[model samples]
Target: MDTEMYIEKDIYVECLNDIGMLEIENDEFFMSPYIRGQRVIHKVLPMHIMQTIFYYTLTLGEFNCNEESVLKTWDSRNEDRFSLEMVCKRWCSIIKASCRSLVLSLNNLEANTFRITHFTYLKKLEIINNVNNDSDYSDYDTSDDEDTKDYSNNDLYYDYFDQRKNITYRRRKRVPNKNSDKLARCLSTTIQLSLPNLSTLNLSMSNLKERHIETIKSALASNKNIKKINLDGCPIGDQGVVFLSEILESNNTIRQLDLQSCGSINGLEYLGRAISNNNTLEKLIWSYNQSNYTSVICLSNGLRNNHSQIKSLILRACDIEGWGALSLSDTLAINKSLRELDLGSNQLGDAGAIALASKINSHPSLSILDLSSNLISTEGIDKILLSIQSNKTLTNLNLSRNQLDLSIPLENLTSSLELNKNLISLNLSECDLQNFHFKQISIALQSNKKLKKLNLSKNNFTIIEPFITIIQSNKNLKSIYISKHKFKSNELFILLNHIFKLNDSIKLDNGEVVNIDIPSIVHQLEYIDLSQSHDPLTKNIILLLREFRKVNNITKIKI
Candidate 1:
């Protein structure tokens, strides 16, 4: 039998070779040849049957169908595994068994009813109702008069509850009741059966109620492995938050919690108390959730204690003014574990910025700081830059969307940055920078060789000579964004000429450059963005792109 099977395999290979359908080299390993053959074999085989065979062979060690394989099969945004399942029953079985996450938007009733039975092993389920009215639930019934009458009103809820209870009992050996019907069954089943190894739970965009919080608390009461939970944009307010706080106070495994846009300040305060003594919690991101100064004060006061373990704090758009920001900065200065702080889009003015910069200068571990969209002007920026000069651990800084003007002395700030060798990524976009500022930046770039990415877009700079000089000298720069800045015709030409001369590809914004030629040294270029640039010579742009493609073997061109 073995001899016959080997002969059949060889015959198959020979037939494929004759038809130019397979390209397998004998010098490679057995698995490599099989993988190569799979590509061609799948083309001839129906998708459903092919998936079944693929999984079966993989389980038998005759092929590879690991996590990467499953991801490749089901990672399409436009198409789901249903298409593959529709091709054959074999595929449907394999996909139903192997799928770990199922996202079903309950927009259509027929599709929801059809697929509900297949979610036996779904570890993560996202159900979104996009219908305009609750009456849309009536469309799923196509039964006898008696059955229709039974499912017409609140009976619909009872039927769904029963179905959920059955699924839960089948998977978890526990029958779900009315109290645990809505979100509890889903969470319980996910925790007990489907997601036994689940460590992260992201319940974003769910309309969770108070009872749902109790369900989650009950689920996490025994779970000791969950490390992260993101409840962003959920309608879990203060009461639900108190329940979550109790859970956090008890569970020590959760390290990162993202409650952004979820609860209010009072809820946050309660949560702070619950996890205040936790030594394992590292990152807490609670940005843009209508947190007031009282909440910030409460959090700041909580962090002042020795038991707090928060290392990174993000409080963007949290209604924090100068006093609140100053208080937070003071707290951060004292906190030893905090390394990154994001206070972007807040009401932190120059006083708040200066206060934070002072704290940052004294901070021993803080490295990355994002203070964008604050009301800080040139003076505030100068103060921050001066503090950066003294700060050794800080590396990445974002100062975008402030009212910084070219009148600010860039030479001093550049000199300070040069002294501080740890800076890597600098964002100075929309700071009203012009030619003189660019000249200063060029000098700084020539001196600072450690910087990798620079964003100077949306500024008032029209002359490109200084920027070109910086690009030519700054060999360490990997990416540069200079979008939305208008340039003169000569200036644009000069900029393109210098960029084409460089070995590293540069990203350009929308602007006109007449008769640009594809440079000979184009192989080193990786990306080019010429979107929204309506040049008079627009017809020749395609030829220019083709020439670039021919010279550099470009893989991506955005025009």
Candidate 2:
């Protein structure tokens, strides 16, 4: 044991000497606490950016904007736009020189910009209004435009998913606009002076009825760097649209324009003329103007000769009809750039459907086609389905609420889907489905793998619920809405509880085996609605989901 211990001590001394941990001076050993040439932990900052951020954090106070406090500051500054550089003078100077965005609207524009000259890095400037969104709405009676549906942060769970498609995805929110025309007109020149390096400008109108449209015309004409502009819920009248038409005719750098829910305007004819001729724009989203046939025809004429840069065109619920659809079809046959087109709830009938189908072979860029609520019959459905067999670009097709006969159209649909193979999502809710239809769809799904979503709501499922027992599994169903259907208790139990395997391997703290059948990781159903089903089945479904949520991270389960 002594010899072994002496050998171990000799090895430890050798290792320490090799690592420079044992200082050798005159044959006497001295142990160093820390190894030489080792890097010390960085105490203050490793990178230059960390030091700069730390300095700014210590200098600048928290950015809190209470209405009364901000208004008080605004009044105190006598409308001089308070320097957004709220840090120390050094940090403020750095940010003023480097900041790419400067937003000044309402009373915030009171700051004079004559003292500053070199704002070369500024890129995006937004000037809306000063109305307190949360407090003002509750106290004052607002219009429908102010009451715009806020679907922000909420999951996309709408039958009408495209309602907020255009501007909602822009990472910007709705700011209440004021009808104070005097304030708007006064701020027009201030808009020009502040936006020197601006690339995108958002001007949400205060009151659609009384918003100063002249300010928009002035701002659009004055800026050269503004490439994108969003005018959400702007109540643009005939005169306002005429001004926009003139500005769009001359503007070359502007690429994206969103005038969603701008129906308060009556002059779509002018806007259509401008849209036809503009070559710089890549995306145009215009909705709720309720234009008539003349305006629709004019818009079609504009798109026919458009340069291939235009990629997306969304015009939803614009009261377009058969003639309107026919005109747009003529343009689609030739237009090369348009990829996404939404014409839902336009009442485009058999003639419109035929015109659109004939052009799909010519235009391969057309991917998303929404013809829901267009009064299309079996003949129209057959025409559209036949187009898919020849064309390969189509992905999402919504033909919901068109009163299609499931018995007649189901055969053609499955065959076309088999041939197409690329279509991902299809909505066929309220189509008067049958038992045989469900059975055939199950058989079709056995072979097809690309088709994902199937919305079977408002179908005659009570009569046909038993037939879907053959549907053993669907791996890609992201969402399924089966509310208001009389599903049998056994059918519900089998479909939900029995399809998935539970983890019986789990045990209790008391060393007992806990075996309760609930959701495990083997389920793929992300969203399901069993609301208003048979009472006994609904109770079981609820109990199952209460435990299901505990186990799985399902997004939503509607009761």
Candidate 3:
């Protein structure tokens, strides 16, 4: 028999042997027939009958079904379909044509073993090179060969010293594996040839260097199907950004580009120039660049001049200070196409907050804003709140980790919370809010019916009445996070009873009458997190909440 037919017969025999229906003795095969749950076959089957069984067994189920249904079934199992593809040539063709998205690990790619060209229908491809672990060294063993040993100080070698055996074994130092780079080169050669339907390409953490960029730059020039490219955590730096900026300047089909932590701070000026010239790019995430304010000014200038369709911009941890924020606010003043802006984790003090607040009211398309950990005090926050009074498009606002103190009367802050009808979610966690601040927020929540989510965790406050009143009145509120609060048992019992309405009244250990009939009209609160409250009475409250959750069909409660 030929090699193909012999391999096919061996696979079928192995499958039958797995279920104990066939056994091999010497060079012949024996069949075991099940008669009344007992194996009784004592003779060998004919070669023609065995061939007939092998052909029928492999062609069963979806294997022989319609091509469309097979494609749909295999599309959901793309990662595991490689094993099934190796069964036969026909099976391989069916599977490879059906795969839509594939995640290939660079560590497993062998030379000329796997081909990206096989997946003809692929639309999204993610190639990743993960950090090396002990599994990568499973095949490596200690060897005393002098030719393979290197004495470089930076290299690591193992020396196994046995006391009882009185023997020392020296392991050969492991050289860094370059298979991923080789596979990346192999992919770069043929990536542009077959991937016509490819749209999203993620090469994050793939250790891409200058050589890989040269090949990728050539491939991306002609590949018009790609729209989103993620190069996060790849040490491509300035040279790689030059190639991408060239692509962005000419390519109009690409929409979103993620260069987070790619060490491309110096090349951001090239990106800013590209942003000025390009018109189709919508979202750009270039976060985690330290002290890149000069490059940010160039980017802001590009945005201020160009009428591009860019929407979401994230500059978290880019060390944007007051001047950078002021420059960005100037861009936001004219560029109405931007919607979501995240400027968290920088030293944007009161000056920066006041600058951005000046543009919030008149800006048309800006909606979501995150100003967390920016050192904004009451003066800046007061201006932001006053701006919200006239702002109609702003829906979500985050001002967490700021020095927020509302001890003195701030009428505009409370007035904005009550008057603003479009704002849906508010985050004021870890803002050093006291009793007076909580009371003011509670007073605002009484009138703000549009607000649905509130996060007030990690604040120093002992009052629970304001929170209970807010929960009782705000029927539109769906979720609340008030973790890290120290609550007494009686206070927690009253809160839980208000939600579940499990009790009318409870007598505390101090003989105080705690009424649970506070009449909470809001039963739509879907989630509540009261975790990290190390009170002794929390255990009973959790048990009661658990029983109430099962009955009321509540979504979640973290206690």
- The most accurate candidate by TM-score is 3
Per-residue lDDT, model 1, residue 106, is 32
| Whole-structure CA lDDT of model 2 | 0.61
lDDT of each prediction vs. the true structure? 0.64, 0.61, 0.73
Off by over 4 Å in 3: 1-83, 107-115, 130-184, 405-411, 518-520, 538-543
Better of 2 and 3 by lDDT: 3
lDDT of 3 by residue, 1-559 (tens): 3223222435555655777775445533343222211121223444445434333433443336654333333332355354343333344555556667667666443432246677788778777665464122334455557777674543466676889999886655566566555656766665656678888888885767655676677667667788998888777777888888888887888889988787766766778888898898898988886646788788887787565788988878878899989988888898989889999998889999999999998889888999999989888878888998889899999999988656544557578899998998889898887777788888898888888898999988776888878877778889989899877777877777776766778666567887675555455689988888757654567578777867887647787
Q: What is residue 66's positional error in candidate 1, in angstroms?
A: 8.0
Q: Ten residues in a row with the worst lDDT in model 2?
A: 33-42
How close is every model to the real structure, measured as TM-score? 0.69, 0.67, 0.78
Off by over 4 Å in 2: 1-105, 112-124, 130-187, 194-197, 208-211, 215-219, 263-266, 306-308, 405-411, 463-474, 503-524, 531-543, 550-557
RMSD (Cα, Å) for all candidates, in order, is: 12.1, 17.8, 8.8
Give the per-residue lDDT of model 1 (tens digit) for 1-559.
Answer: 1212131345656767898887655655464433455556567778766665647543544455456455322222335444444334555566666666555443322234444445455444444433333221234443445432443345343433356556421111222233223444455444544344446666674455556778768767566766777778766777877887787777788888887887566765776676566667788888877777777777887677787788888888887789988888889767887888898998898889888878877788888899999988887888888888778788899999998755556446667657777878888888887777778777777777677767877787667667666655666666676776666544554455455542233333355434433342222224433333424323334444455556655334343
Candidate 3, run of 10 with poorest lDDT = 33-42
Better of 1 and 3 by TM-score: 3
CA deviation > 4 Å runs, candidate 1? 1-52, 56-69, 72-181, 192-195, 405-411, 502-546, 553-559
Per-residue lDDT tens digits of candidate 2, residues 1-559?
1111121334555655686655455533342222111111122225455335533433343335332232211122332222223212333454455545555545554454332234455665556566555221233322356346454543422222247554332222333444345455655564466555667767664443224666657676666778887777766666767877788888877888877776544466786688776888887777666878888887777787745367788777888888888988888987888888888877798788878888875577888888888888777877887788777787888877777654455446666766777778877777666556656565666566677666767766754333233234455556667676666654555455433343434333345543434433233556776577754544545566677677766546675
- For residue 526, model 2's alpha carbon misses the true position, in angstroms, by 3.6
Error of 2 at 152 (Å): 52
